[model samples]
Target chain A: MKIAIVGAGALGLYYGAMLQRAGNDVRFLLRRDYQAIRKDGLSVTSPNGDFHLQAVQCALDPAELGPVDLVLVGLKTFANHRLIELVAPLMQDDTCVLTLQNGLGNEELLAKTFGAERVLGGIAFLCSNRGEPGTVHHMGQGRIRLGELSGGFSERATALARMFNQAQVPCEAVDDLRRARWEKLVWNIPFNGLSALTGKNVTELLRHEPSRREIIAIMGEVIAAGNAQDLNTPIEAEIFIEKMISATETMDGYRPSMMIDRLEGHPLELEAIYGVPLTRATACGVEMVRVRMLHALLELGERN
Target chain B: MKIAIVGAGALGLYYGAMLQRAGNDVRFLLRRDYQAIRKDGLSVTSPNGDFHLQAVQCALDPAELGPVDLVLVGLKTFANHRLIELVAPLMQDDTCVLTLQNGLGNEELLAKTFGAERVLGGIAFLCSNRGEPGTVHHMGQGRIRLGELSGGFSERATALARMFNQAQVPCEAVDDLRRARWEKLVWNIPFNGLSALTGKNVTELLRHEPSRREIIAIMGEVIAAGNAQDLNTPIEAEIFIEKMISATETMDGYRPSMMIDRLEGHPLELEAIYGVPLTRATACGVEMVRVRMLHALLELGERN
Candidate 1:
């Protein structure tokens, strides 16, 4: 399989390395880390193990890479506007574009750029960070969930999952991608938003009673919003709340990506994560008051 | 008129100074600042004027002062629990207890202690700060609105208003104190909660588009909650929104008391300002979602 990973951040590098190790030709499209990665490959330090690729292919421009079998987009959703032009040069007739970014509207943006048939919605359940140029630290779980944007089983999604599983990445193909996004949001909206607003990490947020209650309330809002969209979001509020609380309790106080973005004074992925769902819920006449409040707080914090 | 100022923080000292200047016998009941004020007197630097009371009466114990005509309780609602015993020493049958604290339930707490007949609900439209021990800075408006707790006009409320007006502190007697509380909350819930949550002052919060929208939405929720409690919170949402925006636009980047309390690591008056209204709204089946979210955030922030 031939694959090109765009936006070579921690996610791109981590998964690109895994696919490349499985004998797939994985090329990284980079901007800032292009020079370093081109000179001395990519380095990944993981809890699972440490590995360094010495002869990895890297590209500064999308045109440099000819038509690939799959294009995995790991770019921030804020930069999605440039996707139509940037991704045009890397497509074949059957080329699949999968986005593994946080928040909503990424797959739709891709489908609008490419055709809906060639776009796959993907989510990464991983805790990874780039320590420096060309170096990624894989802290915890690394699983990939991919599905069709229009729902149901797809041969391409199944093949992609099988390929990921062969590489020890633990991939699964679900029937409903939109519901999957909302399921992820049940955890993201409260944990990510509160983490940014209060400057606390996952463990600290779950440990305190007030924040824990807030997390539950915000999660309930998200689930309600999802149900309003007719997405059948699967997990109940209490179940998901307990799941997240117990899952985070074992980690060593990991700071979420949004919290790191806030601490470093960078713009957050507010629109995709918060704005889209809120708008969808409101349009359906469902009031997601808690999520809207969190969205406003994060929006204000980002501007400052 | 003889008066006793309980909780001699900024509001207590400022009003006490004003009433004392009008030839009333004013005594300040102090705790931590008792010795500093007793030794050097209380000083107030105001945009209107600077004044120092070099020989003002200061009492460490409420028992030091006999029953006065009026007892103004200006403590944070978090400390109102101690008022039952503390205020018992300074009240006669006709002595009025006026609370100038922000948020709901202060008058109710006072009424629980000194009966409904002797408790008056007062709202101070002022921005003043205590910079240090025995010193207060009056930055902006100092007008006050006072009314009876049980609603309707009363001779005691009218007399108090007249006395305040004579002291150069503009005062108005309102027909409904509960309605006035709801009116003030239309401003307080949003500004105080957002200010504390986002760590921004009034001007900065009103300046940002997202925070500004949030302020309007939260104010709407508060007004709705007020109406649910049968208080008929007079003003409409849009009018109050525009009113607050215009008013905050002209201010000098002033931080509200809640924000200052958060910065100084003191417990917020969350129960009175946020919790009580939220509970009342919930009990009445009014979904005050935005206010509940803010309450949760402030509660979490206070813990951290």
Candidate 2:
């Protein structure tokens, strides 16, 4: 399959490299890493295995990349303002757009612009960062769950999942994309928001008794809100919270992507993550009090 | 009456200066301002009036200050570990201690150390900060409500209130000290915690709709917890919240002491303001969820 990767941040670069190594044609639409990768190839330093793709396809503009079988979007949600302009050039009649972006609204935006039939949304559980120009570091997990934007599993999604699994990237196709999205937020809303707001990583937050309790309470609010959204399976609050907390225990000293953005003076992806979800949950008659409080605080912190 | 001021921060210095100006013999136990105050005087710049106490009494040690008729404590609660030792020498069988501290535990601790009958708890609604060495800037608001820690009105408390009023500091003798303290927290728990965590002041927090809603919610939690504490009268959430918000609106860009402490890298008075109150609320079977959340975030922010 010929895949065009848009917004080639660490996420885009790592996944694109993985797919390319599995005998799939991958073209990356790049900006910062364009010159370096075009000159010396793309380097991926992963715990799984490090690889260098010498003479990999690198495009400065999506127009240069043109049409492809799939357009994999790893764009930072804060830059969604420029998403359509950058992505329009890569769309063809039969081409599908799969956005593995963090939080809500990404798939909806893509679907509205390029038709719902051609949009698939997924959430990535990858711990990765960009190294020196042309290099990507995959610290850990890279599992992905994707489904049609209209909801429910599809043959195309299955095929896509199989392709990713074959390429050494764990992938699954889900019947209800919304449920998967909410599940991802169960971890994102608390860990990302608190870590970014407090400048404390996962371990430090959990280590503090007060913060750990707040994290758990926020998780309960999220679960309640999500369960109210007509989810196929209501998240069991106690079990899910413990699972998320225990999983985070192993990620000691690990800061979420939101934390990095805050520390690096980048705009937080607030609207998609907090705003849209809060709105959605409220529409379902569930008030995510703690989540709303965290959102308000994060917004205030970003104000000046 | 001979009075000794312990923990001469902005609060101690300004109030101590007022009492001394009103013809009471006020001696300040000092650290940072000892030399400047002892050599020159204590300067207070207030909106109502500016005054300087020439040849004011300032002591570097409680032993030097000696036993007094009244011991006024405005100590930062984070330094409570040294409190017992510092205030020990300034005590006599007849000397009574009035703690005009920000939060809950001061009176209890003092009572436990010195006798329940010798302790009176009060909450100050003061807007002041220390300026250059001997100068204390009294920006606005200096109202104090005090009562016996044992609850109900007493002749001593009434006389103390009269003394403060005679010194030009607006004063009230409340029958229920716990009620007044909790009512003050209706403002403090939200404004202080949010401002300290987000680096936004009162005006900025109120102007933002989300944070404003959050502020109101936390106030509601505080009032509920307070009402459950067997107080004289239950706080009407709507009236009290609006009243607090309107009053804060006048303060404009005021940053609470907690915010300043966070910015200056000083230890926060978290124990008196958040810790003791939270414990008390939980004991009353009232879970102050939002207050707890804010406290946790603030604690986490101060972790580093």
Candidate 3:
């Protein structure tokens, strides 16, 4: 298989390295890391193991990598405006584009850029960060859940999932991608936004009593919003809270990507992560007050 | 008249100087500024005029100022727990205590310490800051609204207001102090919390579309909560929003006290300003979601 990983940040590099090691022709679309990776190649330090690739292919322009079989977009949603133009040269009629980006609206943007048939929505359940250029530190779990944009199992999504599994990267193909996005948001909206706003890591936030109750309240609001949209987000409030609490307890003070972005002075993916669901829930007359409040604060956080 | 001003911060110094200039024996109970004011006197630069009092009375011990005709409690509400012991030696049988603090529950604490008849609630409509140990810069208005905690106009309150009026500090004696506190909270909850959380000043918050809307929504919640408690906070949401917008437009860029506290790394008066009202509102089943969210974030801010 031929794969082009766009936005060669930690996620892109980590997964691209795995697929390349599995004997796929993987090329990284790079920006700041291009020169470093082109010279030294890419290395990943993971709990699973450490791996280094010495002869990785890199590209500064999409035209340099022309039409690959798969395009994995791992850019921050704030940078999605350039997606249509950036991904143009890399799409063949049957080339599958999977977005493992956080938050809402990425799949829709990709679908608008490419055809709906070529777009698959994916969620990365991994804890990873970029070390010095061309290096990725994979802290914990690295599984992916993917589905076709229009729902149901498709041959392309199955093949993509199978390819990821073959590369030893756990991947599951689900029937409802939109609902899966909403389900992921049940955790993202509270953990990601609160972490950035409060300067607390996941464990610290869940440990404090007031913040713990607030996290539950926020999760309740997110679930209400999802159920309002008939997405059937599947997890109950208590169960979801317990899951997050347990996860935070097990993970040793891990900071979410949103908090990392905030500390680095980068603009957040506010519109995609918070704004879209809030708007949809509000349109259905759901009282998603907590989510709305988080969205407002995050908007102010962006300005500051 | 003999007056004892507790908590000699910006507000304490501003009012104490005025009373002293009126030929009253005003004593400031100072902590950080005791030595400076005792040695160099208290100086104030105000829009009304600039004045330097050379022989200002200052005290570190409540025993030094044995008993005063009036004790003005101007400490931050977070420090109010020590009020019982701090103010005990400063009270005579007929001595009155006025709390010009910026949030809820100050009068109750005072009433619990000294009798109900001795406690009065006051709202300071002033813009001032402490420039140095014994220097205060009064930026804007200096009127105060005061009333007896038992909800009626009393002789002590009238006398206090008259004394303030004589000192060129416009003071009004109102019938309902609880409603007045709620009215003040209509402005305080949004401006103070949002300013601290977002790092935006009053004018900038009102100018931004999203924040402005959030401000209105929070104000509505406050009003609803007030009405729920039968305080009858009489302003409509639109009227209140327009009033705040116009006020911010006219006022020069001013940072709320909460924002200043956050910047100075001091614990915010979150419990008094946001927590009390939010709890009361929630008990009455009034969903002051924005206020609750702000309270949660401010709690986290305190922990951090």
Candidate 4:
């Protein structure tokens, strides 16, 4: 399969290097670093190991690229729609697009832009940050699971999963990606908002009792909302919260991306991560007082 | 009557200078600049004008100053109980002490130390910060109202008011100072926490709609807690929230003291401004989810 990786950040770089190594024609679509990566190749350093690869096509213009079988979207959620518009010309009739962005609603966006049949849902569980333009530091787990939004075990989805699994990137093809997305949403909504608001690392925030309780309350609200929407994500508030607390206990001090945005004075994922889930739940008439408070704090903190 | 001014910050300095100019014997219990003030005199600068007097007595040693008639305490709330044992020597059998500290529960701490009869609740309605050791910057309205916590209209309280009035420092005697303290508590509990949590100035915070709404909600909780205590505060939740919103509109660009403490990494009045009120309200069975949230966020910010 000829795969074109669009919106190259840490996740894009990680998959680009892996899929290229697995004997597929993988190209990176980026504007700024095309010349540099074309000259020097891509570098991915992970705790699993380090891989330096050459023979990867890098281009600045999406239209210049030939028709590709799969195009992986790995931009920030805020940039997803614009990038989709930019890369629409590169997709042929059979070309499929996959979005592995954080937070909710990106899949719906991709489905709206492209046909629902061509868009795939993904939950990429990786602790990665940009080491440089061509280098990605996969600090921890780098596993991804892909599924069709319409709950079909299609041949295309299985082939994509087999490709990823053969590349040693653990990939699971699930019947329902909505459950996967909401499960990940439960984790991101609390930890991301807590770390962003308190300016603390994951471990420190979980240790603070009130912060811990508030995050748990927020998760409860999220779970209730998810249940109301009939997603039935299968995790209770206490169980999910305890899972996060236990996970953060071993983390070697990681600041959430939202915190990084706030410290750097960049626009945060305010309306998306903390806002959308609650607003959706409110449509179902679920009370999201805790989530609303977090939204209010984020709004206040972002004021100049 | 002789008076000893505890806490040589801006308000204490202003009060000491005014009392001395009123022909009452006044001595300042201060820190490093005692000798400097004793030699070069004390200076009070205001919009009205600047004035300096050489006859003001300043002492670093509490033993050096004999029995005094009144003690004016105007330190920050964090510094309240810290030097309690050190400042005991300046008080005589009949000496009355007044506390003009910000936030709630200051009077309880003072009463615990100096007995309720000797403790008077004080509120300084002036805009001031530390200009220098011997010099104070007094701006805008300059008035202080203080009275017994027990509703006793004592002669000593009357005498202190007269002395203050004679010194051109507008002074009034209230029947109950606890209510006045709660009124001030409403301001500090919400504004101070919001300022510290967001690290923004008053105008920047209150100008935004979401922030302003959350702030009013938090203040409503504070007012509810106050009314639950039956403290005679009389500030309804709606009126109290409206007043707080109006304050941001009227006062142009002010950063609350909690912001100052966070910027300097000083010990915040987290326990007093947030935790104490919440604890009190919870004990009285008042619902204060916002207060509890503020307390959590402030504590988390403090730890970070």
Candidate 1 lDDT by residue in tens digits, B1-304: 7799998888998999999988999998988778888889888899888998888887888888858888998888898778777788998878988989888888898888679988898999988988788898999899999999889989889989999999999999999888888888888888888888888998888878877887888888887888777763456767777887788788768888888888888888888888888888888898877787678668867654
Against the native complex, each candidate's DockQ, computed on alpha carbons, is 0.62, 0.84, 0.72, 0.66
Indicate whether candidate 1 or candidate 2 has the larger DockQ: 2
In model 2, what are the clashing residue pairs, if there are any? none
Model 2 reaches what TM-score against the true structure? 0.97
User: RMSD per prediction, one decimal?
Assistant: 2.7, 1.6, 1.6, 2.5
User: Per-residue CA lDDT of candidate 4, range B1-304, in tens?
Assistant: 8888877777788878877887888878888568778788888788878889887777777777757877778767777666475457878888777877776677788778788887887788776666666678777567888888787577767877887899998988887676666677778877788788888878887777777777777777777788887764476777667766786677678877788779889878887677777778889999788778778888888664
Q: Candidate 4's C-alpha lDDT?
A: 0.78
Given candidate 4, what's the lDDT at residue A219? 74
The DockQ ranking, best first, is 2, 3, 4, 1
Tens digits of per-residue lDDT for model 2 on A1-304?
Answer: 7899998999999999999999999999999998999899999998988999997897887889978889999999999999899889988889999999999999989888899999999999999999999999999999999999898879999999999999999999998999999999999999999989999999999999989988898888898999998988888989989999899999979999999999999899899899999999999999988899999989988887
Which predicted model would earn the best lDDT?
2
Compared with the real two-chain complex, what DockQ does model 3 have? 0.72
* Candidate 1 vs candidate 4, TM-score winner: 4
Q: Which candidate is the best by DockQ?
A: 2
Better of 1 and 3 by DockQ: 3
Question: What TM-score does chain B of candidate 1 reach?
Answer: 0.96
Clashing pairs in 3: none
Q: First chain TM-score in every candidate?
A: 0.97, 0.98, 0.97, 0.93
Q: At residue A20, give the lDDT of candidate 3.
A: 95
Stretches of model 3 off by over 4 angstroms after superposition: A232-235, B232-235
User: How badly does each model clash, as a count of residue pairs?
Assistant: 0, 0, 0, 0
Better of 2 and 4 by TM-score: 2
Against the true structure, what is each candidate's TM-score?
0.92, 0.97, 0.97, 0.93
C-alpha lDDT values of all predictions: 0.85, 0.92, 0.86, 0.78
By summed lDDT, the worst window of 10 consecutive residues in model 2 chain B runs over B295-304
